[model samples]
Target: MPNRTAVHSELYSPDSADNPSLNGGRCRSCGYVFFPPQRYGCESCGAPPEKLEAVQLGGRGTLHSYATVHLHMGRDIEAPFTIGLIVLDDGPAISSTLANRTDEGLAIGDRMKSVLVTASTDQAGNEMVELRFAKAEGSK
Candidate 1:
């Protein structure tokens, strides 16, 4: 069995899988949503600093843009990997790997859903997690 504590520490620390889904900072006073989780005053309507709150976002989205990477920093991340910008159904867009498929038949405007996946092993031999998108069940 995997060491749960080590796995959690490696995969769930800071910003990888702890929150799994993307989040935004919402202005409590004006309901403005800021992607990348703002820590200061609101960008919309200039709300005061005290009104910001972390909001969990739904990970369902559509493919906005994509690219098939054949090469990466010395790691050779497997050829024909599809990386895409997913525009969340209710919030901002994020860049993530499109899971369970190669780039051969992928196209823009494809619908996808976010999923947490084991990315790889770290230098310490612990598992790492990352967010990825995949075709929704029954999607063409």
Candidate 2:
């Protein structure tokens, strides 16, 4: 197998493709948890930036909603890709690209888990993997 690299290194680690962890932030003052971590003040309360602490959130979540894109203009990805809004078990809802190319058998409230999918290959022959959600095993 070729070497692998994460597309968004800051968001998640390049390893643990089977069971990934999300880089999130929590407000020390208001206990607000959020993903795609930021250094800015808490959006829930008026907590200062210093009160925000980095956290490793579980990559498991519930599929709240989803949509399939049939058309695309971007060069990075093609059309017929699916995006899902998942509410993490820890807290906060995040919209992420789904591992499935299309939303065929997907349903709301399905158990979801994170997985790394090969987005592209780097010039140095490294696989660029990106985090995406998929229906959990044995989940109906």
Candidate 3:
């Protein structure tokens, strides 16, 4: 097996491909959960930065909305990709790139789950995996 690494090590775990989780922060005072793990302060309770603690948020969610991108100016990802707005089962809503290139068989209320997909290979022969959301099996 080739070497594998996460595209964003700060966002998700590089290991645990079978059960992926996002690096999220929770406020100890007010019990608010947020993604992207911020250390500034709790948005819900105005607690200090010390009140925030890192937590693992599950990668299961419901698709709230989605859009297909036909125009992109970034070199990281090509155009004709799909982005989905998912309301996570834990608490936060995150916008993740869909595994499918297009939104052919997607719906607003469909169940979605996180998946690791190969984005590119580095010069060192490491497979760079990116966390993406895909329509869950047997979900409508």
Candidate 4:
């Protein structure tokens, strides 16, 4: 669970799991998709801000890029972990952590799915939700 203020406004709520996925803004004028969902105006075609709509993103994506993090800035999550960018199947690319790391065989361009996880905790001890990418089951 995450407090409204504790959650990233640009991201959807992890708990909802229904409508709560990354919200993207699509320009009705040019069909441009904006990740982090634009609030006021469109960066492309100068579309009016009112023309943008909130679009729920698909949880499936391809592992665009990744790296094993030996260190991190936050204490809530353990270090020596893996993080990467997932280019959603129908949305913009987002940076997220890999669900499980096994020396077995993780590679780039692997297909993955989004899973909700605890990103960190607030000073008041509220858990912050985040999206993590995991290799799709049966993927090798």
- Sorted on TM-score, best first, the list reads 2, 3, 4, 1
Per-candidate clashes, comma-separated: 0, 0, 0, 0
lDDT of each: 0.67, 0.93, 0.92, 0.72
Which of the predicted structures, 2 or 4, would earn the higher TM-score when compared with the native?
Answer: 2
* Deviation (Å) of 110 in candidate 1: 1.7
> Candidate 3, TM-score vs. the true structure?
0.95
Error of 2 at 110 (Å): 0.4
**Candidate 2 wrong stretches, greater than 4 Å:** none
Per residue, candidate 3 scores C-alpha lDDT tens digits across 73-137 of 99988989999999999999999999999999999999999988888899989898899998988
| Candidate 3 Cα deviation (angstroms), residue 82 | 0.7
Q: Residue 135 CA error for candidate 4 (Å)?
A: 1.4
Runs in model 3 deviating more than 4 A are none
Clashing pairs in 4: none
Which residue window of length 10 is worst by lDDT in model 2? 10-19
Candidate 2 local lDDT, 51-109, one digit each (tens): 99999999999999999999999987888899999999999898999999999999999
lDDT of 2 at 41: 94
